[model samples]
Target: MVIEKAKLFENTRERWPATVYVRPSKGVLCFVAEPSLVDVYEAVEGSCAPSGEWTAEDEWTHLANWSFHQALWALAERSAERQLHRNDVTFHMFDERMRFNLSDECWNAERIEYEESPSRFD
Candidate 1:
């Protein structure tokens, strides 16, 4: 089922942790905002799915991405009519655009449509 964007956000908010934000953008069906290293580690430790097979060690980054995408796939499979490839969703971590303080109120995920970029060139 082809879900509307509004419904998709509603479902994502209900299913994912408040720390995780998912939205749709051009060329991507879903985009998970930057995640915190701590959150990723915790997910890996708590995961019961096949992604749990990965240890939060040397390749923790890859495992974190895999685990997150796996969760995304399941969510889409349940609610979306279109098939989603692993590449359809993406996420990154530790970018300068975000601060790592998990307790920060600004970290809460929400749908925000910025009227304009701070930099015109961006």
Candidate 2:
């Protein structure tokens, strides 16, 4: 199943503490716990090219690309859409972009889990 769109949520108390909801073609929503931006940056920085040479910009680019892939994988695993792994998830630029605008949200907001269902959005 191809991902139609993704909704981003953030914990108000901490920076980069976020979650992403990936909606696939079958209409099932898969929730993924996203790591902090700092953590992703550090991990990408530690892995370098064969020559062991990298710049700050290169690390940032790698982090962005890797994070997107991780989100897709999370969606595939949680949605039980094993075909997504083989078919590849594609996104369109004009697709819907959703964001949860939480007011006075707490740290616990980061730990919330969404159950799978047919009428989840309805």
Candidate 3:
């Protein structure tokens, strides 16, 4: 019973939705405007499922010229679509770039998006 309860909590937390704040850092892999600026965005399940490509027009060069921003986001989109569990990820939010540990899931990257309005409701 105790073990079952623990699993229940885990499931709830995983699905409960959240708004995660990511602090900008050097390894984040995106367009960071300023040293103190933070990026903000929302993601859920498959956040990369928009009409456009993963990278902006100017950033879309070949592998040789591709910046980390393009490479990293491309990797992230693959992970999210396939639900591939990865140890690290780059996220764009508040206009700054940041990263998140994804050893267990692609869910954490999107929790904030899923729960955006929920935070307000709460």
Candidate 4:
């Protein structure tokens, strides 16, 4: 269970923010962002209703929820090098099973080599 935390930054070229995960000994593992619904639910269980259901009317509403947003912001703030505020950052998490390892790193680097390349999905 290698739980990795990442601080997200605005990606002007894309819709989602961006973050780079690294190992102290190794260089950058990969760049990632856009936490999936499963990742969000696991990170902040309280965001769900009593019945363990998401109640937001739309995806925007769900992402805008204060509790969810704050939780991720807090994570990012902790890992951030500089002093950042709520709107300044967002956060995401990944594990070894995801794309935070040497194998995935190769896929990301040499994507053209493989037809079915894996994603650095959060």
Tell me the alpha-carbon RMSD of every candidate. 15.9, 15.2, 17.4, 14.0
lDDT of 2 by residue, 7-121 (tens): 3111111122234333335335233223433454455445545367776444333433444445445454566322333113333211111112111244124212211212213
lDDT for 22 (candidate 4): 17
Query: Which runs of model 1 end up more than 4 angstroms from their true locations?
Result: 1-67, 70-79, 92-122
**What TM-scores do the predictions have?**
0.23, 0.29, 0.16, 0.23
Between candidates 2 and 3, which one is better according to TM-score?
2
lDDT of 4 by residue, 1-122 (tens): 11112211122112223332312222342212244423544543443365655553222223323333444444543453333233433333222212222245544532232224333444
Ranking by lDDT: 1, 2, 4, 3
Give the per-residue Cα lDDT of candidate 3 at 43: 20
- Candidate with the greatest TM-score versus the true structure: 2
Poorest 10 consecutive residues of model 1 by lDDT?
Answer: 110-119
Worst 10-residue stretch by lDDT in candidate 2?
93-102
The weakest ten consecutive residues by lDDT in model 3 span 57-66
lDDT of 1 by residue, 1-122 (tens): 12133333233223344444334434644433435324544564454345546542323333333445455544443442333433333332211112232225553431121111132222
- Tell me which of candidates 1 and 4 scores higher on lDDT: 1
lDDT of 1 at 86: 34
TM-score: model 2 vs. ground truth: 0.29
Clashes, model 1? 1
lDDT of each prediction vs. the true structure? 0.35, 0.33, 0.27, 0.32
Positional deviation of residue 117's Cα in model 1 after best superposition, in angstroms: 25
